[model samples]
Target: MSRLATSVTAALVVAIVTSWTTVVGDARADTARTQPCTRYTAILAPGTWETHIDADPAVPVGMLRPLGDGLQWQFGRDITVLYAPYAASAFDQGLTYAESLSTLEATLHHMVATLCGSTRVVLAGYSQGADGIGDLATEIGNGAGPISADRVVGVGLLADPHRDPDTTLSLGNPQPGDGIAGARSQDFGALTERVRTLCADGDLYCSLNATASPFLSALGKVLSGDPAPIAYLIPAYTDPGTLIEQAVTVGAGWAATAANLPTILEGLDTLPRLLTSGDIAAAHQIASGLNAALSPMVQAAASVDLTLVASVIRAAAAVDPSGWTSAASVIADALAYVDIQRIAFTAGHIQETLWRTMESLTRNDHLQAAAELAVLTPSVFDLADATLGPLLTAVRGDLALAVDTLLDIGGPESIDELVQLARQGAALASFYGSNAHIDYAEDVQTLLGFLRTQVAS
Candidate 1:
């Protein structure tokens, strides 16, 4: 054959062979994924930001890695271990909790559908992964799941946000409270005896003082894909009596801000000087105090409905014009040009920036602290100049007048006391920063022991 013809034929042959090999490889992978185990299967879901949507199922990662490895070692060739792949992220990072839940449910359903009916199933997860696993267990137990509840031989969860102490077996020391996102509305039904949860003490994701702060509880519920709390919260803010209470509450917040404004501003003014003078410790102290004083205001700004507050103030003015007229005018004017949603967005960003700055200071990361403060300082000043300057000025100018107006509306006698309650609610939402939540490896042996006992039977 001619050289040119031979070269072209050889190139075509190579291309064809490569394509055939690729096709065979993909077919084999698919067959392997679908192959069912004879005895048992364990499926593990990792926590938020731990695994990607297209993660390799063979390589386990995150908090549940130890448990996955232990199960493989114990069962050897008798069982199959699968790590679910999903977009494990909270709303702020990428996907919402609800989206993650949906992805996890689909993954479990596919596995259960493909597995042999007689093959026992084990499930495990940690943190947000635990949240999804617990929910699935509840669904399956209630007879609406992808497989029969009896197929589930064991389930283990660490730091499950929807943990119900009454229904699920808890392994560790008694937590002070239920999960931060609150307990599941429905029990685990048939799987109640099979499912187990462990929460480290002081872990806010698994335990939060919900009773002490119903507002925070409601916020948690909202974040967990439940809008039921919002329905109740919205009405509470609009009811006449509740409106009066909230008005007083907000007025009290303004009053506190008015009192602290000087100190906060002075601190801001002196912070640059202190940093320039190389007095980092003094700057750190000032930043700490600023965080303490500003945290509540930022939380209030993010949480409070100014539009609703304005409505309450207007209603009060209508009821007692003589008492509320001037206060109403000032507040109305201040709110007229304000965007409630933007205020919330700005406040949330500021709160996060302030927190990062404080953390840097706490860690004694001077360069990082300076960098964070540099970002924070201008942001704060711009917020004051554009958004808060008018409102704060009004509050500072007629503090007593605003207090009298709220009192005249016939709510709490002491606005400060009511504001303290609001502050407590904000505090409940803050993380406890416990290492226990992520220390699942410490308890993996206990988890493995439980799984071994359950599966062996």
Candidate 2:
């Protein structure tokens, strides 16, 4: 079955790439480049969506606009924006990710060929765009891409899905692995000094752990019935950065889930049963379907109870510890309890379930979490203790605060309080997950300092 799955995945990847390649062929010419060779500093912002363009300086879009505007204001030279049009669609991350890979590469190739001699390029991107820009940075750092390392001032990535914990690219908190899509072929071993990677706490795309991401990758494959997307996770698991990245991603995922209290509750309700079930694959499929139904914006957000799922799954497998020939099978069996047919993936169902689940998770003073923890098998508790016990304890206070705020907002309450809760949740998530990426003002200033030093040199 795995072999058949692999072959199917390969075929799907080839087809997706072939079709997207056709669309991207002509689009490469659209990689907007600035001219007149004025030695102006350049900021390339590949907006998360394909709609962003470089045509209007008056209109602000993406991370580059404000930063570029500031640089222009300070130096009196307009900053150039490199625009690459790629499908930054949601849910269909695999397709958009592939498009970004190709389009951004071509775009950078052109920019370097035309402007590198006279321009000092500073690259930045957000979300999917960040993934592409990070890849480009890796290539340049490795001396394998179009632009020479010296000609590039620095690179900044926001919520990069390709963030690798092992790379010196990120100066914030430490993680265990690379992005969900995986790490670059070559490490940014060369660009250590020039690269700055910022991944928000709980942004699962960049920070999901190496040990656990395969489950997510497999879950994605089983649910989506496509293999290409799973490809990223395979290589990603091997990257030393995968573990730490997964940790932070998990944190961010929990934060987002908390913000979408309704949606997370739905998953939380079903998670315990699936984790304890004898059939792991079925549990995984059900979990995947439930996850698929989650808001794409919060898809990476796994509820805080996810640690329980991990613990129970591992504990269940320990029963046949000697009987298991391979750990993969153990993991797969752990996911074998969920029935997709019984599950609902519709937006309406998700919304309804979100509200229902929120009520269940929070009512009785959020005793559900305590109940789940109490019922865990000793082995499972041990597993949780070894893995996420400390993390959960550390974040418990914030989680309580968030739950309280959420409950208050669920009633007829002030929008101000709700907004305040949102802010608190975001801050807590960052604290738990290493969302240092939010410090953009400081990051940009740091970048400006680097550019100044580089130009002076």
Candidate 3:
């Protein structure tokens, strides 16, 4: 279906579901239980990837332990850890995210149904688990979930991939658009004051700047086979001529120093990769088939400017080697030139790269692998609850074949390698990692304090 038709159909389905939820909620007037709970607080944590309930919360030492352990220290028997489990593997993220969300909804309903009226629930999660909790919070805040917004004493989501831009209560800069999977169709205005989205700088999953856009757009295109939204972004980006014009307009007499050449070249090399590295697969796959589709236009628009930019930088570096600040200035000028274009081409590059990659994948007859990933596109409608459920279940079989295909798509040697790379780069570097994917020790303390105030006993 065309993007427009698909979008319209999805919207109609959401409208129907919204009406159904409202009617069901009205018929069940008694949403909360009458019995008073002996305990004041209950904590629920979802496992990042699991098909069943987790035995324990997956947190690093001295991280979120303070909340649970501290609460136990205050009231030993009052604290209960409810580990929310679901299929959290990368390949099944779409399925597990939905299934775990439903499981959490059912669990919350049961808790409110049987627990004491005064009980306050504290929700916390990390990574995929964070996405599930954040999504649930969005649902409750919007008055569509099983639980009431008031019952939520505190919510702590570490590295939540679905984090919305201005609404986050946590520290860190705001990102463009929304999370990697994009924002919920509705707002969480109900929990606006209570929810916190903590993200460190350079976490691509939350931010849409230089590092995130290319990868996200690429992933989006591969999964959806649509790129026009991102493709049209080419003109919006700074052209090489614009940067050169700006530099010459400054007309500051800055000559290069021998000491600065290495740094300048390094920065130039790193800058291009930084802005464009997200197209790893695209770089490899573009030649496979996209030549007939996108190459001509891309070449016509980019060839002269690219060559001009490269020539200017090389010439600038070769001019003079005596002025100390001149070399540094040249480097700075080059960096500034690259930054704007980097931001601009991110979306377009992602589209081009993913389109090429898809073409190659199909030609290679990696049909099942391609099909498995095709269903993971971000949508306002619930794909898991829809007809896609059976496919999700069936794909779990033939584990070896599925894993191989997914690994290639992700550009990782193995799952372990990807995990290691993520851990190393998530908070500091610009590789494929999210701000919401790190170990949030400080946030745990904040969560504990927030819960303490809400459940004053």
lDDT of each: 0.62, 0.46, 0.42
Best by TM-score: 1
For residues 134-212, what per-residue lDDT tens digits would candidate 1 score against the true structure?
8888889999888899899999988888877877888867676777678888998999899888887667667766655
Model 1 stretches with alpha carbons more than 4 Å out: 1-30, 33-36, 226-434
TM-score of 2: 0.47
Pairs in steric clash, model 3: 36-116, 37-116, 49-88, 50-86, 159-436
Cα lDDT of candidate 3 equals 0.42
Pairs of colliding residues, candidate 1: none
Tell me how far the alpha carbon of residue 197 in candidate 2 is from the true structure, in angstroms, after superposition.
2.0
- Please write out the lDDT profile of model 3 over residues 1-457, one tens digit for every residue: 2455434433543453344334533232234233234465554554444334322332322234566676656666665544443334331322213333444444444434444555667776665566667767777888876577887766776656666666777644444545555555666768777777665454445554323232232232122122222222212223322333322222121111111223323432332343245343533343222222222223223323433333333334332232212332332333323322232243244444445545656677466434523432221012112212432343333323423443564446443332221222232333332334454566666666766665664
Model 2 error, position 454 (Å): 3.7
| Weakest ten-residue segment in model 1 by summed lDDT | 228-237
Write model 2 residue lDDT over 296-379, tens digit each, in one string: 224332332234333322332232222211232222222222221222233333334334434545564346533443433332
Give the C-alpha miss distance for residue 173 in model 3, angstroms. 6.6
Q: Candidate 2 — worst ten consecutive residues by lDDT sum?
A: 323-332
